[model samples]
Target chain A: MLWEMSASHIEESQDVTSQDLDEKLDLLSLQCLFLMNQVISMKVDIERRMKEGTGMLAKARYVMGGSSVSTLQIPSEEAGMTASTLSSFEESERMIGKSLRLKYYNFRVFPSAKVKDDTEDEVKDGIEQKLSNLQLDPRQSQASNPLRWFGVLVPNSLREAQKIFGGVLLLCAECSSIESELEAVIREIDILNQVKSNRQQK
Target chain B: MSDFPSSARPGKLLAIIGDEDTCVGFLLGGIGQLDKHRKSNFFVVDKSLYPSATNIEEIENAFQQFVKRDDVDIILINQHVAEVIRNVIDRHTSPIPAVLEIPSKDYPYDPSKDSILRRAKGMYTAEDFR
Candidate 1:
């Protein structure tokens, strides 16, 4: 009679555990759905922007061929063109849940010319290297014009292409963060699946 | 001493491995960079310019090289070009230096073939929720 009572209690606890796992799995799947939608929309946006940017680029190439832009062309090696990234990713973790989330941040444009000066200042302040101590003057930041690398007198088509692609680059950055989140949700679902299967087997 | 904000620079690069037009468009955006090693973060896989010149190995190599680079935080490849090296792209498991397969001038975006989307769909069906 005692064995029967203990068996009924164990069965009741098993049912509750499996029900909890099911609820968790459903929540994760819903998260996956949301993330999947976000990614697909971003992909569509990327496609449209890329098509427009490339079309403008092709037009620029054609215009260059018809004109004397060749004389103004800077050799790849000589241009020495380098751009400071305007975006970055920050990683944070939920220690209890054991899940990772990547956050994307877009920074203001800092011209390459100013980068050297900033490095020097940073070196001087090495004693107090805390990021909070550094006071960033907004007016000090300048608009980034990469077309200056080609020449001050670049074709209109080229300028338009640059503007279009710049937006696309930011979109790409945002998409990466969303995609990473989707990966995390999928991982959670997989773990729950293993737990559910293990329970069933036992 | 200018009271400039502590370096807003993220110091990370976005690498591209795409066709001619894709490379040109993005390069014009000011993401183009050439390091002291004379190595560029972006690689152009153009077969139209030099017909049949770009091979699978070259594409794979560029993708692998970009993945190995520590400074690159994001790698963007054209969807059509990514098809040539789908296996390599799928094999990459790192969440950092995220790999994003984007559309190109000639090809449109297809979500079904997207590596991440496919994995999500494969994991669970709508009926499973029911």
Candidate 2:
């Protein structure tokens, strides 16, 4: 009876040890999931913030560079943004900075990789000559804007759609021409089939 | 990666505007596309080329064309090359393809010249009271 009790105690200890191991495993897995979630969220957050900056800059430029404001006169709220819109935008601007810091935090010292050898003047002169040839001037801001004067031309989407529409129209025209050719070939085949049938009947 | 086709992914293509070494490194990573016209997804900026003027113009045009293309997802430009066309880079507004500045062989990346980072700093100075 004493031997049996000792055996039972040993079995009980083994069970407790296995249960402990299982619980530890579960906790480790949970921690792994949490870290993965954080990293994924950070990546998504960075992308969203970058996109936000691009969109806001474009919108701000459009409003500030409105055609009606030919002079440096104060732009009307109706031309671009209202007082409320500007204030809310001010709030989003803060979030934008925080997110960018997150992206730069790790690679902040990345530029240290560059080796300095060339004189600054030589580099600047080369770039200036290149810019002139490309008709791009660092002095002129609007020259680089791909969508410059777009605010005056058409709503951005309409312009994009017009380009897409032209492409689709070309595709449809090609398809119609091909279809006509196919119809002619099919008519010729039908007549040939009828002639074969007439000869078979004879 | 198994769930979706690669083409369906937003910003599926990465465009680069950098020096020969930078372009070659990216091309080795499988981002290079060459056409019959000898045009590619990247432009190699070589200061040693005979006509330095034409090289810069070509780089500027390549950068502009890449920005205008629909297939490109992200534009990675060397800080040195970006300096040459900083005005054009600053003027670009579309959010679909984000333009990012990277260091080159000769020049260190400047935080002050970073448009996005500069905008982010501007927000920190806003009036706030707790």
DockQ winner among the candidates? 1
Q: Which ten residues in a row have the lowest lDDT in candidate 1 chain A?
A: A95-104
The residue-by-residue lDDT of candidate 2 on A119-163, one tens digit each, is 434645432232222322222223212223233453443233222
For model 1, how does the per-residue alpha-carbon lDDT over A66-184 read when each residue is reduced to its tens digit? 43322133236524556544445555333222232323222232222223333545655421232223222233233334555555566788767766676677678778877877776
lDDT per residue for candidate 1 within B1-130, as digits (tens), equals 2324444436678888887778767766667777767788888885754324357788888999999989887889988888888999999987766899999878799998899999999997688758
Model 2 segments more than 4 A misplaced: A1-202, B1-11, B49-53, B123-130
lDDT of 2 by residue, B67-87 (tens): 887765466676678877878
Instruction: Kindly report the docking quality category of candidate 1.
Output: acceptable
The residue pairs in collision within model 2 are: B11-B73
Overall lDDT per candidate, in order of appearance:
0.66, 0.39
TM-score of predicted structure 2: 0.36
